[model samples]
Structure formats: structure tokens, C-alpha cells
Target chain A: MDLQTSKAPSPKLPHTALDRVVPHSESDWNDAAAPAAERHALIKSEAAGVQLNLGELWHYRELLYFLTLRDIKVRYKQTLMGVAWVIIQPLLTVLIFTLVFNRFVRLETGSLPYPLFALSGLLLWLFFANAVTNSTHSLVSNANLITKVYFPRMFIPAASVGAGLVDLSVAFLLLVALCFYYGVALTLQILLLPIFVLMMALLALGVGLFAAAVTVKYRDLRHALPFIIQLWMFASPVIYPTSVVPQKWKWLVTINPVAGIIEGFRAAITGQHFDWIHIFISLVITLAVLASAIYVFRRFEDTFADVV
Target chain B: MNTAIKINQVSKRYRIGGLHPGYMTFREMLGGLVTAPFRKLKSGNGSQTLWALSDINLEIGQGELVGIIGHNGAGKSTLLKILSRVTKPTTGEVELFGRIGSLLEVGTGFHPDLTGRENIFLSGAILGMRRKEIERKFDEIVAFSELEKFIETSVKWYSSGMYVRLAFSVAAHLEPEILMMDEVLAVGDAAFQHKCLDKMNAIRQQGRTILFVSHDMAAITRLCRRVVLLENGVVSFDGEAREVVKRYLSSSLKTGALKEWTNQHDAPGDQVARLRRVRVRTSDGVTTAVVDIRQPFGIEIAYDVLAEGHALVPVVEFYNEEGTELFSTHDTSSNWRRQPRPPGTYTSTVQIPGNLLAEGSLVGHVSIMSHFPATVLHAQERNAVAFQVVDGPAGDSARGDYIGPMPGVIRPLLQWTTETNELSPKSNVQSPTSAGNS
Candidate 1:
């Protein structure tokens, strides 16, 4: 339980100051005779170890909670409609996707109504997308705090994702209601819903970490991230069902992790799950991407506070 | 016993360079996204190493009050960040033995739209105080901050003074084992500043450790027992207060007091006399070292009093850096003071030192005196010289050779005023100043 040795008193409290002042002069300031800057250089540059120190993180849990809550509160503060926008954003997006894919492109929605169908995927996918994208720049955006006090740097991104969950849950209630409104029968496959949702969260976190790390070193990522996410959404099966993809290119389609998540989403709510082979492949690819994201993020984590 | 905070060879390296301008080539904005990221990838991280602190090793005993001092570009902030753990060191280690609470910048971590009460919880949590602990101290914090009525009001509407009082109150009230504050005293109005200083002293009275950084030398002298000076990312000095300040002051080499020699005397019949360069220094002009307060000192003025049909006189003045005039004197015997004078180079001096100044930079002025502020006989001033003071080694003998904290600018060698009453106990009455409303 003792975090510190018994020797030195923690120099963090204010006491009766004796004003034992020691002044240093200009000749002392320009102490070229001052020693050279030294550092612990033997650590491997390519192999920074992974440490999930839950205790330290736990010690700071309340701070984590407040910060996440702050983000959620601040997002809607001074705004019209306040929390209503949480539902409107997803609702509007569903309408746009329905128009663009179902009406114009005329993609078949099988037995499910196109609006109800796409809305579910949109709600879940939107959360994953928003959380990932926002988390990507969380650390850099809060540079003021990052540069001033010490806390687990990972909490910044993690909190952003946590805050997004509130909106996700709100938009999701409408998705659930829409499925029932469409006369879709509830299936036990819904049990697997949380699994895919989690996978989506992890997937976002991985990509987000990589992007956040890259953004600090190159601010251009700020401009590129939205474009990248937009293009990525099309590549995923959000607009069209994975079932419609031609067999010849299914290999490439399965490689995209979101492809499996969206298809699994349809099967979970409706009854048309994608091929098991593709779903498993998507899971594997998602894990691989996440591991790489963690690795890349850890490699550059120390540099973040400096440049940001 | 081991030190409370042991900084072992800690050093931080920052990258130096700017990010590449927006995406794509100069032509790419017009050409679209085709030219970018073809085969190679290019984006953000472009910086080199700028070591903020190098080979810094120090062991702070438990409950030691340490003050950090330095000029612009010095690594004082960097060192604080490292100790507080906001930023990781590129090399070395920081071994902390107790809880650390930092007030890096007031009102920085507050959310503008959040009510003052919400911000208290938020800021407290961010400062590492547990929820239960904050709940316990909640009322006391509000009472100390004197914002009970405005607690529910959002910080956006809080006046700057109100904001500072609330923010500083929260930080000061935090019962952390170690506290790190940056220039917290150099803020707000005089009354508020006094309150902060009182609170700071109270915090120290409890056996807790603290690290403070300030530009106000007098405050530093009053607050810190051991002062460390940094210059250009390195520790410049680490000794007694008076000695360090004296060395910094007397060592001034401002291009040997520039001489713009001009003989524009008698250019006009009315503006006959002209003034040359004026320089202020120690009585012994050759002793360029900083003037010591314990001893007497003088400022020198040089001028050319040409034959003038009009009256001419010279006035000398002294002012602290705050522009507060300590005192001023003049040559009432000059031509302007009495009659006219012939053409010749003349030197004038002003002298004083007996408990008349404070421990800070002083500037002097020499003006051509005339009919109630009317100039004509070279009414220009010689450059102001900076001098520092050191109180005798009498008070706070524990901080031997150090200019300990004392009230007033001059820090006079005054007698004591004291009365020892019954021990009502230090436990019951909390210091009646700002406390954290976390």
C-alpha cells in the first residue's frame, strides 16, 4: 500500500516556509560548465513494451469519469434542442443513406424495409465511426491539460469513446423501435449483437490510436481523417448488403472488418447473416489492425506531449 | 529517510520544427487529390530534439518548500511539468513519494458552460482528489472561495476576479502531500494577492512539501527557503538568495552605456543649452556589480549646461519597476533653479540607501528643470539603472544567507509584535482562506 519509500517526504504540500533561499547568478545561468543533458537511452526504439497498469488507471478513475461526462455535457451545452440532436443526427443520416442507396441506386433491401434496415447499421456504425474519429484526435486536442498535469494519456481517447456511447445508445433506441415497427420478428441472434458492437469499438480504437498518433506528428491528418472516414464508409457494407457482392470479389470484401460487422448486424436483427467464413475473417483482420494500432500508438506516445 | 521527490538525471527532449502546410502540392489544391500519397506517405510529425532539462539531479526532502526562479526560455516550466508528470522525460526518472497536486494555470481546466460547482468537482477530480474526499470538503471549499451564492452559476458568467478566487481557492484547499504552483501569487488585486499569500503560508505550515515558480523576487524571497535559478534549459545557480541576485544584477553589460555625443547647444536663442548622455551607477562608477541594499549607492548624470538667457535646472528621480515613485530629488542651485549658466560639461549625482528601497529593480531619471515643467535647456533623461537589495542575516535564521519572506518593499529591520495565547488547538480551526470546493 505504501507508494513511496520512507526516506523523502513527498514535495507536494505547503508548509511554514522558512524561505531558505539560494540564488543563482548570470555566470551561474550561463554555466557552460553545467553538465550535458543525459537520458536513459538503452531502451529499444522498435520495441516499447505494452503495459496495462489497471491500478494506476483505477486510481484516476473518477477523473476519467468526470472528463468523459464533461465532454458529453459540453457537446450539447449552449445549443438548441440540446439532447434531441443526438437522435436527429442518426435519423437524418439514415434518410440520406436510404435516398442515396435505396432510391437512387435502388439497392434491394430483401424482406426488410430499406429505411429500417439501413438505420440499424447506421446507428451502430455511426457510433463506431464517431468514437474512432473523435478519439483519434482527443489527445492532441486537449494539449493544454496534457502538457500541464500527469495522468494516463490513454484516458483522453478512451473518454471520448466513452462519451460517444451516450449518443449511440439514444440513436440505437430508435433503431430497435424501427425494426419492430417494420413487423420484423425478434430473434435470439440479438445475443451476438453486443459482441459485434464491442468488436466495432475495438476496431475504432485501433484505427483511432493510429490516427491520433499520426496527427500529432503531421497535422494534415486533421484534414485527411474526415475524407478517409467517408471513403471508408463506402468501402464498408453500410449502404448495401454484403450478400449482394459478387463471389469473385468476396475475398476483398471480407478483408474489410466493417464488412463483417454490418453483415452480422443485418443477420442479428433480421435473419440474413453473411457467410461464416467472411465473419471470422473480418474478426481476424480487426484484431490484427488493432494490435498494430496499439503498437504504433505506444511507439509514439511519449512524443505526443512534446509536439502537441 | 529517502527524499520525498527524487529527480534522478531527468531530462526532456522536445522536437523542433513545424508541420508541413496543408495536404497536396501548391498545384494540388487546384489539381485535386491525385498527386498526393501516390506510392509514398507524407503527413504530420516533423520535429527535432530540444532538451528542456538535462542531467538534472536533486533530492527534495519531505515537507521542503522549494522555489524555482528563471528568465524567459529557461526550463522552469519544463522541470515543473516533468515533476508533476504532465509530460514524460525523454530520459531519467522522477521518484515521487507522496500525492502531488498542481495548479499549473488557474482556470485552465474549467469548462466555461459548467456551473462553478460542477467545475469544482471536475477540476478536483482532474487534480487527483478522490470523490469521497471532495464530498467531505465540499461545503468548506465553497465557504472559503466566497462564491456560495454563485456556486450554481456557470463559469462563463463568472467575473475574472471571481473566477480566479474560485480556481485558486480550490487549488489551495486541496490536501495533497505535495503542491506545485506557477506564479499563483502574481495575480488578482492587492487584497486578493495578500489573501493568496496568506493561504500559501498556511498550506506550508502543515508539514507538506511545495514547489513554486515566480518572477517576483520579493515574493520568492518571502516564500521559498531554497531557490534554484535556471537559464537556457540548465540550472544556473543554486545557493543563497542575496548572493545570486547580486551576481545577476552587478554583471549587467549593456554595451557600456551608449554615448550619443551631440553639440546642438545654442541652436536657438531661447533653446540655448543642450544636454548630453546621462548614466546612473554605483558611487564608484567602475564598480559595475549590482548595488547591495545593505550599503550606500548613487546615480551619476552627465550634461552640458551652455550659456542660456533662460533659467535651467536638473531634477533626479527614482522608481520601482511597478512605476511607483520611491523618492525624487533635484539640483535647486542650477541656472534654471536660480539663474542662467555658461557652456560646459557638468556632472550631477543622487545618493541614498538607509532602508529607503525594496528588493527589486530600480530606475532613475534626470530631467532639465524649468518654469514648472517647461523644457528648453536639454530636458532629456540619462538611462535608468537597475539595483537590488538584501535584508540583513537577522530574520529566519533557519534560511541563513537567504533573503527570507518579509512584508513591505524595503523589508526594514523592524522590532517584533507577538502575543502567545492559550492553545485552542490547530486541529479545529481550518485556515480562514481559500479552500478547494472540489
Candidate 2:
């Protein structure tokens, strides 16, 4: 008998103390013996609209924490390198770019080594790319949870973005060591590094939520996503500096929020010129994309359980 | 009596067999958008809409354990889904008074790659348990699952039973004020099922409101005092548990006491014999879909003998609602035992005496067998007819005024002889009349 014969404890009765009082009618629901009224909720069949309920999101914050932890843990479960692979992805990309650019195409990188400049930009780029790609498929992958349980559906895509932060922070430490080896002096501009990372997150979340919701209805996005991302990577200044773009075509960097953030991130780390106008424009676009993505996500979320 | 949940004028409509069905890709959807205006004239009539639920209004009081039972497509799941807020009703509102938790399925958010220990916390949080609550009762959950030895092992390697145990253990510890379960007890081994039932009973005693949806009639009748029966997206019956369960079982039976084959060429049989019709009737020979428990009923089977020179026997098998075969009766008359009938139609009937069969739905299977040099089944029909056996309030049958559920497939009234010993040293023995009255 593999079953243990230990006596299971009697489950706790939450209402035992209160039930000792005399019974009351339904009208006395707000009385002392009754459950607090704040727990009451009314569910209806109306469109969610564009209402933002921060309190509801706050209530399910623990679920977001657990889901993000699960993603991070499961991503490295079977791999031999585990967290080491997190640093390896950006390092290997920097290695390939450094070899190709330094030997053949000599695009001038200001003051700092070309390898250091590319690694700094790839830090934000890879996080944005990985976060967007993973969150895009998060809803479809967790279809079982969507149909069976009730929670903030947005947390699913949001957690994928959160998981990418763990990898980003680990890769950030390697960039710090390389900075010291290159003897690049740090300055007050480095304080703005966190702002750029925040912008990158908002942008990824905006695109991820929209794509995840759409993919639930039209699955062809799953096949077209990698190709779209490959082309998007070329448009962003990951391997090269933004200065390489001609002055007439500078509007490309202005509209691409990720390009501005990456350029801002590299500038901040190397203590170079900060593109204030471009960073400000990227912030505005990031917020707009996030707001609209949330709108489309909220509208489509009601039918996700039915169709997914 | 505070209302734990209230559902108001709820109705859900789903489009069926529509042009835009299930899911569409981006390209196909784009094509739909281009041609939608042109196709609008033919679209409305081509699609069909089905109302899964219509005008459902229910107010459940706090601390009530209710059972909901219905046949497939009866809208039980739809109602549960609405209450749990998994999907919204097309038109309705539901007000809930407390922290609502629903276990529509076990192991819904389990990650197989995570270890048993990690999954316990993850699954617990997904089921709406606070991290501190889970941490406080973590050991209890592991103990209840009985997988303490393998807590650190990945769940992918655990057997299915172990996985269900871990998932259910996390769910069992959830202390929601109102919980809705949909056939969650339909798994696991018998011993584990018994343990789960015990845990549910404990939860019920804690004054938590529970809405249980299941097809297990025995469990429904045993655990719930109130049962609701849904039929065709409407509430058909709501009251005492046993009565409603009884109604649900009999109503689920095929609504026919008689089956007939109008075309003899398509009837069931080889060249030897063919069945034409089968029916259930009382002693008065009136065909009925329901009969009294204390009244005798007959199954009449009419068939045609095509090329018969061999002796044939007609048989009828009786089964209860649970598909347990109660008894089988055959034509045993000596005159027809070895008699070979000429090519013609023959009618045979089997009489089941009063107080012999249980008070539930009974299904009859009719067949004909040829017995001469070798025994061979010539014609047979499964589920030929179904009829409900009802117990009267007078209780004159084998139940004999005892109103509780009688545990047997057949309830036969038998004679009993009682003899009191006069030479007994103990005076506690009462007289026969007194004893019988008591």
C-alpha cells in the first residue's frame, strides 16, 4: 500500500464562530457577523470598454508574480547551461558583430570600443525582442488556464515580459565587466539607463499584448512573427550606431521607439550625447502603443475563452 | 439568510453553422471583410443561432450545498461558466456576495516541467490562494497528497494518479466563501474518491456555499438536500434531492414505451425470424411509458417467422437505470417448448409481477433464439423499450412505508414467519403484534 495512513486533519471552518449567533435575513448582509461588503462583485455581459481598474490588477498581483516565476524556472529547466545561457546569447551576438564590423565594414563608433557599443545596444534589443516574442504566444500556450480559471488575462502576457527582465539583468552584469576592461569612464548619464529599460518594456508589452490577442483569433501571426521580428531587428540600431543613418532618413529612428531607447541606452552607458528629442518622442509612442494595445486586449479578452 | 449568489434573466446565444465560424486567419478574415457587404443579403438566413440558456433566474442562499444535474447539452456547464465568470452570458447579470472560487477542472494551470514542490505553490496561487496561506499549509498539502517523498521531483515523471492527487490537494485547501465544482470528483481511485468526498463533507459543514454539477446520481442524493434539474436550457425541477434526482433519471430515459419497425424488409433478423414491434403494457394491456411499482407489467414482443421449421423462444431482458441487468425472462410454456410454427407472425409477452422490480427506469431488450439441433440467436434488438417504475405514496410495495432509498436492483416482497419463544429467560422480547407495530 503506497498510500500513507496518516489521519488527515479536519479542514478549517471559517464561519464557525460567526454561525453561533442567531440567524439573520439577507437584508442584514452588512452586519458584523456577515462577510465584509468589499468582497462583493457583480459580473455582467457588457463590453469591458476602455476602463482602467488598477485595484483589480493589484488584487491579482500575486498571480502575476507566480506566473512570472514559473516562466523563468521552466525556461531553463532542461538546459545544461541554465542562467549561463542568458549571458551567452548576447555575448555570442556581440562576438559575431565585432568580427564582421571591425574587419570589413568600419562604421565609426564614438570613443568606446565597437564591441562595447554593440553589446550595450543588444542588451535592450534582445530583451525587447525576447519579451515581445514570448508574450505574443503566452495566451495561446496557457489556453487551459484561460478557459478554466478567472483572473486578469493581461497578466499572462505581462508575465512573459517580466520573465525577460531576469535574463536582461543577468546580461547587464556582463556589460558592466566589459566596460571596466575598456576603461570607459562612467558619468551621470548612466543614471538614465533605468528609464530606457522602462521604455523598452512598455513598447514590448504594447506590441506583445496586441499580437497575443490577435493570434488567438488569427493564428497565422504565429508563423509570420519571426520574419517580422527579423526585419524589425534590421530597422533598429542594434549592431551599428544611430549616427550611421543619413540625416534625411533620421525620421526612421524617431518613429521606431525601440531604436530611440536602444540609442538612448548606449549613449547613457558610454557617457556620450543623449538624443533628448528622440528619447522624448519614443516615450510618447511607447505610451500610445501601450494604451491602444490595452484597449484592443480588453475588448478581445472576453471572447478568448470561447475561441481559444 | 444572506444570498450568496443571484443570477438574473440570464440568456446566452451562440451562432451555429455561420459563415464566420470557430476561428479565421488574417487572410481569410480580410477576404471576409472585402466580400462581407456583397454577401450580407444571403448571410442572415444561412446562419443559425442557438440559445444555450434562456431567462435563467436563481438566488442561492448562503451556506447551502446544492447539486445541479442534467443530460448532455442541458446548459449545466454554461450556467457554471457564467457564475464563475469564465465567459460572460450574452445578456444577463450575476451578483456575487463573497470571494468566489471555481474548480471547473483539476490541474488547469499545472506546469509539468516544474517540480512537485514548485507546482504546489504555483497551482495554489493560480487557484486564488494567497502566498502566505499556501506557505502556512504547505506541509499539510504535501501530507494530504502523500507525495512527500517525491516533492522535489519534476511532475512530468509522476504517474497520472499522483498528478491528480497533487492538483486536488491544492484545490482542497482553498477557503473560498463560494465554490463551484464541475465533475471534479469523476477521477482518481475509489479510495481517493472516498477521501475527497470526506473533505467535501467537511467543507459543507463549514457553512461554505457550494454549487456542485455532476452526473453521479447516488453522490448527488447522498450529499445534497437540494437538487436542481435543468432541461433544454430551462429549470424543469427544483426541490428535495431524491425527488429531483428521481425525476432526472426517469426523464433522461428514452421517451418511448414502444418501438416498431414499419418496414419489415429493414427489420432486425436473418432469414429465420424478424422483429416487428416491442412495447410495455399493464395488465389491462394499455401501452404506457410509466407504471406503478406495485402493479404487474408485461413486455409484448411481436415478430414474424419467415422460414422457420425449428422451434423458437422469445426472450426479454430487464435493466435498471444504471444499466444493471435485473433479470431475464423467456417463454417457457411446455406447449411452445418444442413446437415448430409455420411461417406467420407470432406475439409473445412476459409478465413481471408486482413488487418484483425496483422503482426506477427499466429498459427492455427483446430477442428471439432458435433451438433445435443447435442453439442460435435469430433476431435481437437492444434497448427495445423503456418505462419508468414509480413508487406510490401509500408505500404498499417492498418498500413497505419506508421512504428512504432502497439499495437493490429489484425489490421483491416476500412472506415472513415470526415465532416467539415462550421459554426465553429474557423478558425484553415483545409480542408479535407489538414487535410488528414497532
The candidate scoring highest on DockQ is 2
Q: Model 1's DockQ?
A: 0.18
Query: Relative to the unseen true structure, what is the Cα RMSD of model 2?
Result: 8.2
Q: What is candidate 1's lDDT per residue for B1-438, written digit by digit as tens?
A: 446678877766665544323222234343445745552344333233466788787777777777788876678888887777666676777777666778778865788899999898888777766676568667767876789999999998999999987887667656556778887677787656666665655556655688888877666655666778877677777766655655444434342222334555522122444556555456566433345454566656666665645455667677766777777787774444556556676776667654556666666666765663365445655444445544433443223333334345454444543332223446686343322421
Listing every candidate in turn, what is its Cα RMSD in Å to the true structure after a full C-alpha superposition?
10.4, 8.2
Interface RMSD of 2: 9.1
How many angstroms is residue B195 displaced in model 2 relative to the true structure, after the best TM-score fit?
A: 3.4
Residue B113 deviation, candidate 2, in Å? 0.3
Candidate 2 segments exceeding 4 Å error? A1-38, A47-50, B16-19, B36-48, B236-251, B255-438
Candidate with best lDDT: 2
Report the C-alpha lDDT of model 2 over B1-438, residue by residue, as the tens digit.
999999998887766665546567888899988988887787564256678788888889999989999999899998998888888887888899887779899887899999999999998888877787789778878987889999999999999999998888888777677889999888877655655565565556668799999887756765688889998888889998767876786566664788899999989988989999999988999887767678898999999999958699999998887889998988988988889878999999889898888776778989999778899899999999988776643546775533334578887888754433242446676454432444
For every candidate, what is the interface RMSD in angstroms? 11.2, 9.1
Show what share of the native A-B interface contacts model 2 retains: 0.62
